[model samples]
Target chain A: MNTLLDFLRKYNYFFVFILLEAVSFVLLFRFNNYQGSIYLTGANAISAKIGGLYNEGVAFVGLRNRNKELTERNIILEHQNNTLRETLARLGHVETTTEHNVREVLRDFNLIPATVVSNSAERINNYLVIDKGENQGVRPEMGVIGGGGVVGIVYLTGKNHSLVIPVTNRKSSISCRIRGGNYFGSLQWDGKSFLRAYLDDIPRYADVKPGATIETSGYSAVFPPGIFVGRVLSVGNSKDGQSYRLEVQLGTNFSSLRDVEVISTPYKVDIDALLDSAKVKDEADQLNGLGL
Target chain B: MFQTILSRIFWILLLTFLQVVIFNHVHILGYATPLPYIYALLILPSNTPRWLYILIGFCLGLCIDTFTNTPGIAAAATTASGLVVPWFLVAFGPKDLGDDDTLRPNHHTMKWGPFLRYAFCAVTLQCTLFFTIEAFSFFAPLDLLFNILGSIVLTMIFIVILELIRNER
Candidate 1:
């Protein structure tokens, strides 16, 4: 008893360190997915205020760039409006109502505007912080897009903030297909450059051309079909001789991302629940088939 | 002693705030996150109790983890750093130093060569441990190596800059 007491007294500090670290590790590994998400809301709110101040100081420097971008956007909108007017005139003979038009517009695409609060480009698994959150209808697995093209998928959501796993992160993989080809593969970041990613699982037999645009296939509930991902920069045969790896230049300049839109799909929950139940039934059927 | 404790606490808080508020947001190169503020925790007085040092280190890292949404990453790294600091101090203890000594490594106190060596080892170990745990089980070996080296270089530069600023002040 005396020997044990002496040993404990001598190494109490080490024991405490081990105890605290073990507790922290358990907390981290167990509740990491959800509790860590809540921290972002408070952090975002505080950082957003600080970012606001920082933006004010640098507003003058960015004015010219912002003006140019707005002007270009105005031109595009004007052109789009003209085309729509022409189409409306052509469809004038058909019975048209305000409700039909509103539905038509809403059916094409829904955009939820969000501001970038924090962004990282220098990590293998980079995440972007956006101001919109669950309250704003931004949920995990929602698609995010910026001015350039497909930005990323929402991974974590807070009360009034969310974190996006951008295409630049190795952890993010988007199901993509070539614009006119039957071949599909996963678009994954190689943690090398912001402008580039790798397309894996593409069969060597498929005719892949450089500059072929890749877009979301709408297979996932997160994004609608035909959302631009990037263009193939280069392609090479893999070591296995069964697959080809294509280097793609991402459409969005993740480094300069400021404003983004979270895509909210109304049918997500219903579809997800149906699919999950189907999976469970399939597993049960498989088990029954294996019974003696 | 009270002033010393108060000042150290103030500096720790200030550095932690700056890390999460300003430096954490700065992503300079596409895989190298600079964490200059960690130096504040690294340079705590050598006489601080081992258990207290480890606890403070854990808290420091936990605070960062909470802010960054990276669970266990900073905590693991900071704990490792705290464990190693005592060894480092004893190994590099100043010759003929008095028991009442409270001297810290700075431009005025320690010679430039020994100070640089000490700072390099401490900062390098911190950065290496941090990157190792953060990239654990998720990244390629080459990627992990690059991240550690890149972060250390950037962090070293930032530390030197801070030292210069402190010297001027």
Candidate 2:
């Protein structure tokens, strides 16, 4: 017993090392699936505090540029607001009886503001860290967007912080379609340039012109339809000559993304459940149809 | 002993902050991300027990892992470094090497040829391990190699500058 105790004492540090490593491995592997996003929340809280401090120091340095951006955005919003008002006026005022119905329709989509705490553009699989987590209604598979357009999808959510697998990450692919065309392709980052990505599965017959706009297809629950993704910069036929590969310029300037908005749809859960039930019903129908 | 503990804590915090704030921001060659913070683990006192050194290295790495949200990466790299640091010290023993040799912070005093080789080996091992674990999957081997080489060269340059500053002080 004494010898065993002595042996254990001699290698205690090794035991500690193994224990710590085991803990880290578990965290890494189980991070995304874990229901508790407290770590992300804490990280978001800390990052928000740090970002506040950083903004104070650098605010003056970028004052002119920020003012210009604000003015541009304000003008765009004013135009959109005017257009919307005109459309509403043409339709005439809704009856008081329809007020509740309109409110229910408008509640389908919501935009939650968030701040980017850490942004990486250099790595092959770049990830964006945001200061919004599950506590703030951010969750995995939710779409994120910025000033320009679609940014990425939420990969993992912590309590206060969330990690985004940006459009620039090679591992990320978003289903997108060209404007005014039914043809759709998968947008994938080639892991080379920040401004560019590749569009795959585009058939050769699809009319893809340089400078054509690409937008989200709404096929995925993560993003809504018509969110700007990119513009085609170049097109090349595949080596086998069966399909065309498109090089696209990303809409968002990921290098300078400071603030982002998470899009939450209230109908998402209900829609998903309905679709799942429909699939089961269809499967049951198929079985009955096959039976003699 | 108190001083040693305090310095260890101070250096770990300082190095980790410096890594996140300054070095992580600098992209000298578009791919290079120098990790001089690993030097905090690399330059421990020689007399520290081998097992203790590994434990300290592991903790230092875990601290970094927590901050970066990259689990197990720094821990594995640092543990390997700690295990091999003793051999590196022995292989490159200075003429006047002693217990004080471990305590000295000056990396510039060594002859240029020897210093370069030692720095190369130390930084290379750390970079290789770090990038290997970070890439994890074999799909991006070219990218991993590019990152490792670029980061090692940049880290070596930074280490040399740091050594020069230490010597001047």
State residue A261's C-alpha deviation in candidate 1, in Å: 99
Docking class of 1: incorrect
Please list the residue runs of candidate 2 whose C-alpha ends up more than 4 Å from where it truly belongs after superposition: A1-16, A32-292, B95-105, B108-112
For residue A152, model 2's alpha carbon misses the true position, in angstroms, by 99
Per-residue CA lDDT of candidate 2, range A1-292, in tens? 9999998898776676676666555555454233125446756899999999999879888898999999999999999999998777646734332223323433567878888899988889899999999999987888888766789999999999999999999889899999899788899887888999888888888988999988888888777777778799999876688898899998789998876778887667878899999999888988899533
Model 1 segments more than 4 A misplaced: A33-292
DockQ for model 1 equals: 0.19
Q: For candidate 1, lDDT tens digit of each residue in B28-65?
A: 56777787766766567767888877887888888888
TM-score of structure candidate 1: 0.42
Chain A TM-score values, per prediction: 0.61, 0.59
Please provide TM-scores, in order, for all candidate models, with all chains considered together. 0.42, 0.39
